[model samples]
Target: MDRRTLLTSSLAGMAAAAASAPETRAQAGGSGPPPFAETMAEMTWQEADAAAKSGASVLWAFGVIEQHGPHLPLGTDVYIPSAVLRRARQILAERGHQAVILPAFYWGINQVSGAFPGSVEVQPATMIALMADVLSSVKKQGFARVFCTSGHGDALHNKTIFDGVTAGRAASGIDAAVLFNAPLVKRLGLDTASPAVLGFEVAESPARFIDVHAGDPETSAMLHIHPELVRKDLLPTLKSTDYGPADLAEWRKGQEAARAKTPLGYFGDPASADASRGAARLEGQAKAMAEVILARVGGK
Candidate 1:
């Protein structure tokens, strides 16, 4: 048999066995937004085999450790998306699809934010190669259906991710779908989908006034997902700074230009952030993504 055919056949038998056998820790009863049920990092090889056998659609997320002004943690990107995907998994399970969360790919290319302190970034090419290799690994592990999600939103960063997906699918022949928020994807204007590299889109938040980095949406998201990580005290003094088209063009001229435009490393109005809005943003984004994944993959 060819690779996909062989893997599918093996899963059919293993799934039957898994269904008849006792539930592993992954299937144990839980409540209230619990941790990932089946993670590659946490599962034993035997348990992972059972997960593979269960035909769970594998999921992985991408983020970066970087400055988000002075109020949010460097891990703001990682925490928010991980929370969103955790909720997405719950929504998927409710719709009768088993999705296993893989450990997140947190290290990422940080171009716009590279000028800031604590911004650990890799070259764009490095990110692209890593994406290709990671997806290839997933395909080799017999996970035929997979999804990639990202929390970071830089146009260049996302492009590298998209290219990596292309290279990975070309190299390994897995049917993987990547998802991103619609506005940023539209802004990037990337031809983001193909048969081999399917992707879905969701709105990152409700309509915002003057939306930009480390602003209301992002700050509120961190407040909702990781409240302790937010510097609530500093929020009161940070003023609103909007970067219009011309302003952004000027800002991107160089790192010094960007830093000069936004001295404290933030843009938009952060003092206006609200945790209630944050909760709603999380629910909206997570639900939109979950619904699409169910429609696209259908428990495959």
Candidate 2:
């Protein structure tokens, strides 16, 4: 059998074995632990306090609602971060670490898609304020180690979010840290070059699907994560413009180059994306993120 088929079969067998194994307590048998979903929801004030008392780290997924070419949904940024956080939590639990992911922040600065339909753009200050409040709330609950992760590629926006988190940490006197996964992906030696674009990889991986703007990667990820949200047959074929942050002032020049670029707001080839590759990438990202948390919070 091919590598994909073999890997899938092996994973299935391992899952079957795990399912058949008797449940074990965290303190006694040291085997199975509570599933991540049980801890990631919006908890009551008292619940948050109790979790904080347990000294667990809080991971917040920062996302945005922006236009992703013509094929991908506006909430692609939001969903991708959430997926990464969930996967990270699973990995942490397996390693006997107490970490819980929080809901994502969907509003962010979106200059590229500001003109697109259904795209919601927030002021940089507004994003900073909102994130500060969210982190403050988490801090109030006694979570000393606050971790935030963003999937959005806007470097400035992410910096603002991190800055806000820093303000919250200082104001609340809580030991908190924010992580930007796009940068982390690069630090982990992942080939995020033009061909092996991280964004495209995120969409196609098993944990999600490869739906480039609504093409393959992003569409495939949506298919795997929330298949009902995808309008697969209604794929669009409009060309997208290529305008990076550096080309903001020279609009005419950028637009001219954009005309010759790919139709979808995507980089790299999405045709090669598959569920197995997506799953593996997700796992790698989660592991790298967890290590960052551990290092920051005194994990051995």
Candidate 3:
């Protein structure tokens, strides 16, 4: 059998066995949420197999450790998307879909901020190889479907991730979908105008597309998710900075050659961030992504 066919057949058998056998319960009892282990780190081989057999979709959280101004933690990008994934898992399970949230991927291409402290940069080629290997292993283990959710938004970072998905397919016939969570929020028309979840639009609370990093959206998110990590004193004094390049290529060259332009290493109006608005942003993103996953790969 071809790789996909073989994997699908194996999954079918496992599902059948799982149906007849007593359910392998997570640590939690009722329908509150899947065990912490099921959604986060420390998942064992048995847990993974059981989840896959139970028709659960594995969700991979992808993010990077990089500079996010002097005020925010270097892991702002990682933390934001991870919060979304955690909430997304709950949303999915509530909707009758079993979803496993994996650990976040820390190493990513930091072309713009590599010169700064606390930024860990991985080359495009290396990232592609690592992603391919990861997908290959997931398929080999028994999962027929996978989804990658990301918070980082550099041009090279996105290209590397999608290329890794393509490479995984070419190298091992692994089928998966990746969603850059921030862009997905915008693309789904959730970024602007009024949203159903909240009484008002969160557009004002987040940074504009051009001023993505350490901006209102991220700062607000951090304020809501991990208030302790945020430097409340700096919010009053921080100002907005724009990345004024016409295109991604120009962005890479300009930022690298002139690091002094963004001495604080942040953009957008963080002063306007609010905890309630940040919570709304998280729900909007999670709900939109959940719909996409259900429509695209939930049956598979």
**Largest TM-score belongs to which candidate?**
1
Report the lDDT tens digits of candidate 3 across residue range 1-300. Answer: 999999999999998997888432232233322224345456777887898777777787777889888778787777787888888888887888888876777799888877788899888899889988988887787777677777887767766766776787677776676665444445434322221111112233332445566778788888888776777788889876655545333445535642566677775567777888788989988877787676655432
Per-residue accuracy of model 2 over 1-300 as CA lDDT, tens digit each: 999999999999999998888442322332222223444565676777777888888888777887665445577777666777787887777776787677677788665445555667788888777767877877777777777777666555566666677677667776656664564445434443422122212222232322223344454454455444444443434322333444333321322342234334553333433455455656666777887666666675
Clashes of each: 0, 23, 1
How would you order the candidates by lDDT, starting with the best? 1, 3, 2
Score residue 169 of candidate 1 by CA lDDT.
83
TM-score of each: 0.82, 0.66, 0.75
lDDT of 1: 0.76
What lDDT does the true structure give each of the candidates? 0.76, 0.59, 0.70
- Badly placed stretches (over 4 Å) of model 2 are 1-42, 182-220, 234-272
